[model samples]
Target: MTWDLLLSGGDADIAISGGRIAAIGPGLPRDAREIADVSGCLVTPGLIDLHTHVGPGYWGIDPDPIAWCSGVTTWVDAGSAGAYTVAGLRRVAETAAVRVHALLNISAVGLAGRTGESRDLANCDVALAIDAVQANRDLFHGIKVRIDAETVGANGVEPLRRGLEAAQACGVPVMVHIGTAPPSLDEVLDLLRPGDLMTHCASGIAAPLGPSVRAAAERGVLLDLGHGSGGFAFDVLERQLDAGLLPTTVSTDLHARSLHGPVFDLPTTMAKLLAVGVPLDGVVEAVTTHPARALGLSCGLAVGAPADIAVFDVRKEPFTVVDAHRQTRVSPIRLVNRATYVAGRLLPPRLPAPPAPWIPLTGAQRSALDHRTRAIRDLLTTPLVGVDGLAEQFPRRSK
Candidate 1:
């Protein structure tokens, strides 16, 4: 059977048919209906962000605009919706071009507001959470609970206990967000199961570097670098690296607040790992195979796998990148996405919407946004070509 699309002349020739990779080799047939020449680009599996917020809520942001340019195909909404608001998130997942899965919030209220979701213990209903996960098995991969002073308040680890109960009942893992004390970082880490994830493992505020943290790592609690606006810090990551602890997954907690600065996209977040001395291959694995394995999702660029691919122009130039704390470091290489595909269909370019009113932006950031808007407007308004560049479809009577 003929192939549907051919991605030729990249790192390797890939033939896609029936929404899966038909073949991969140095040379392939050029008879596909659509052919994209991707010479001088790095071809790899589409990235999977393990933590993000894309549902319709306070922190939600459209993932398509970022996905097309950043090569992220699967966006795991980390508790933007819970039992009460999951239907709305379902509608979003169904309509979006990119794949959107979620971790059901322990709090029934969800992130309708910034924080304090688990302040009221009634919101953390284990039965309701178990029901939600069991009912929507396709959409929810696990449960998410924010354990910190701001989110849990006086409840501390009680919400986490209820979340764990629900996760155990549903036979799914839990991804716990780590932040400032009250419950204390050790209290949260001790409760996580072997397969459970500790997001923001290298937070400046939490600084999960004590004996309990090491013990948790030894016992098999996976560490995830959920680099949100305040979750990541270069010093903290470096310290962890010195201790020989590498992040199991790298993700951008891309929401309204973090999108503009610290966590621009997955590529940028990956670069942060690079700056901290992680090898390129390691960083790629963290974003692709590792995260996919964590959530039991399909990923990779092998024959018979779903054709979710990304082509990037790999530049071996120095690039200055910053973490959530505004500390900067230079990366040896930069990965700029040139094209992204999902299920053998190329994603179309999409412009980002204006930042939300409540999202604070610096003067320089505002100016940059304005400049980008004008540039896009100018480009779309301009003519495709001059008169000479056009040809008439209908000839005159002589023709």
Candidate 2:
């Protein structure tokens, strides 16, 4: 458990009931159904993954298993759904017990069919985006626009302009994914006001440690390293840091494509940052308080804060840290989750609850949202992108 009082020092006890943090202190009445002692563990608020893609119309990975297994309580599905597609995707994401929220995609089609959502420009319908955000104001937290060569094609700055237009209307932050630019890094930074975000800041764009980034920071433009399948670099981040740039929040841009290699999970991302010279406290704050504030999610160990806590065992051993581009570094200490508690229900469950919306390792939601599975079945009945076609992704070199 990463307690705020941890730094102050002392053994404190916590009590939970009625899906809330009932109390916290050094001692309390021992009158409870069960009691567990945590003599040696680092306790903190439940980790919030501020960026993820975990629903259909994309290569969806059911979020609960990975999320809970990683000690994540709140998972934000970043731009995986949009105006036209959010309704069904929202259902799939919410069906899991993991608290799920989303940054509504600016494009109407979302990430369906490996399609470049904003490529058509017509997909950036501000009215439709506004409607979606308004309709799902409960779960929709912000707007997302991936302004890159693949997503936006040569449509320079227009998609972001439209996204900003809709975000301004909806009164939520606009998270801009910066990659192979149609709108130059400078152009994107220029358009972003304070509170707006630019993710993948270390993706080795022309985002040099220079005046533009400095100006953005000065104006309170929040930066995040959304370390995705291809969104981080060692030298790039180092240069930015040397030039006084820093991430306000850190998140795993977790998706099916990134689940295996390069970006494994949040702790792995945290370890990589630790290897890069960011202080331990900063690393902790990045995932905990930083994202909580950025996304306006209730987080902490206080009585009113969501009863979400993570117990970590700090390991003082050597570990391999991998960056988004497969770069490696060695870190001194590894933060390992000893246990996690969300709303007082212990994770790695002490006693399994009845058919809850929690971890469903084999749960296949057979609703209409299961259309992606049905489509996969249809493809299997016909043919896949064949072994050879698939093998192209992992080409073998001649012996």
Candidate 3:
């Protein structure tokens, strides 16, 4: 099998021909047309970011090109669309560089506010949600039900109940936002089916998957690490991980704030788990195969699957990782994304350069300038203040 170009071993490779991966293997045949060696790099299936906000309006400005540069090839815009603005999101997602998907917001108005709109049943019309999902079935993967403190307000379980009903009609999973739920996590987990998803799992005082959370997983519900700016907490993650529980899918929950701070990118979030002693294979599975399985996506390196892969270099580099609280930690090792690919296209590269400090001035030159300034300013406070006399005495020494 000849190929137009071949990335021979490292992280992953996509054998592209008709805009899809024809094959993926450890090595391409020697007869391949063009071969690029990727020795000393790590390659795996292309990253699938299941949660993001790549909309058309204020939210659309996010999930930009850097996301690709950072190693994400496919992304899901989480609740960036509502009834009012889904058309705009659909318009842009059609032409975006990265492969984009969406979990439609339950609100007919879409994501117009930071606080969300699940608090009012009047704002959440099941008829409208079903109409939007039916109209844009191709672009929409599921429904987004936000249950935050402000969004749920006094509505309690009513909003989620409506959301679940709509989800049933749509015949797709519902992505529930986990924060302040009135009926408790147990009730929320019970409402969701095996295919339904829970985002923002590591959040607030509420635990993502506890006894019932695990029961939800046992029943086939997908647990997403949807770590956003203010949504992720180390304590919550620790509790779950310590309980020997892992998420079915790991996502960045990328938005405006997380992209710049402690959350970093998908690779960084994976690195956090790695720093905490997660085996390399387990971490890789959580992001790649596991996520794909949870999404009911076939992403193994099997023949005929799309040739999408994410290549990285797991090195012991000094990384200053920040958390949600603005705390910085000097980590000894981290997963650094080197490149990414979707189908058969080689994504833009992400090679980092060595760090070097700036040498502003020579020592001798600095000393001479310091002495001259001191001699001149020394006279400003003197009883006899003579600028000309000072200049004459100084003589402007030069090295």
Candidate 4:
């Protein structure tokens, strides 16, 4: 499937050796020592997350353990540090358990806090950014700029301009985060080239799905679904998808705070897109093939492409999913990952964590929580007898 042609579906098996896919067919000799049965699960290339802050930032998290648990082989930390601080970021990435890459922040301080990185235009040193990219070309693949209300309060599109300058100077791509606009989405789209990426596409929308987005998309300006804390609004995504415009790649703009709410994990984000009416195949491709292409990484199920693979169970169940705007939707399918292999090395998925403890609650809050818990416990003790019991415990929303 990596090549221009499609794969023929039949009973098939894949073999790996020396950290590369060796053969794929039936009746292949057991070249390796181990074999396991993986029936009734969909397999694809290892997922490449294009946007994250898993480095040493305020919202950063250690990526490798999470990556292994989530079937993510390649994790891109988006703009956690800037030109002056990227050396430290590189040092951290070098010791990571997964394949780690980063985008050089246009601002010199780079997302140290929520505000003031681009408030002063002097903070964006194009020369220093280019120098950093050149110095760490192996680790830094692109440039990152946040064009939101906080990052660019009065500076307008100057931060983006410097980001573009740095990208052009270093001959790499630019990943722009869209937030509240003073320069406007139209102006931002005008500057981006074909290979450049516009993240947070499902964020706040000021207008309908009109010609501006279409024009940029036609010019090959890729859109990215970076579902951060409040970056993805269901209405915005539905409106855009209704216009037949979908993101080229999907990413979980995962940080520390967002992990607890609206954006739980990458699998939840993928399930959200599937519930929003995107095809399941397209959803998997967005995380695998599309992101690999966007980030210039090699990934596939073919021989010698890479031995990385991910296996998941496509569960069919009724679940209530929520978006960043707190709107709930029903998903008929959930993608639960089971395992990931990095360069022919196997990594198994772990069990999901238990529910959060009520330790951080106030005295009144704890009392209320205990009361609710006991009420639910009482209902459970007498449940499943009849419609009356079910209705009393799980009442439908009042129409």
TM-scores of all candidate predictions against the true structure: 0.98, 0.83, 0.80, 0.83
Highest TM-score against the true fold, candidate: 1
For each candidate in the order shown, give its overall lDDT on alpha carbons. 0.93, 0.76, 0.70, 0.79
| Candidate 4 lDDT over residue span 220-239, tens digit each | 98999998877888888898
Query: lDDT tens string, model 2, 1-399?
Result: 323222112256766665677677786666555565666766778888888877665545666666555678888888888888887777876577678888998999887755488879888999999999999988888999988778888788898999999999988999999887566788889999889888887886545466898899899888888888778887888888888788888888887666655676888788888888999889889988988888788888877666787777778898888776667888888888766677776665321122223213223332432565576568669975667676566778999
In what order do the candidates fall by lDDT, top score first?
Answer: 1, 4, 2, 3
Report RMSD (Å) for each prediction in the order shown: 1.1, 13.6, 13.3, 11.1
Cα lDDT of model 1 overall?
0.93
Would you list the clashing residue pairs of candidate 2?
1-42, 1-43, 1-44, 1-311, 2-43, 2-44, 3-43, 97-357
Task: Report, for all candidates in order, the number of backbone clashes.
Answer: 0, 8, 10, 0
Residue-by-residue lDDT tens digits, candidate 3, 178-247: 8765658787788888788888776654667568887887888887888777666666777788887677
TM-score of 3: 0.80
Q: Model 3 RMSD to the real structure?
A: 13.3
**TM-score for candidate 2, residues paired by index:** 0.83
Regions more than 4 Å wrong, model 1: none
How much is 126 displaced in model 2, in angstroms? 0.3
lDDT for residue 291 in candidate 3, whole number 0-100? 63
Over 4 Å off in model 2, which ranges?
A: 1-11, 205-208, 348-399
Best by the lDDT measure: 1
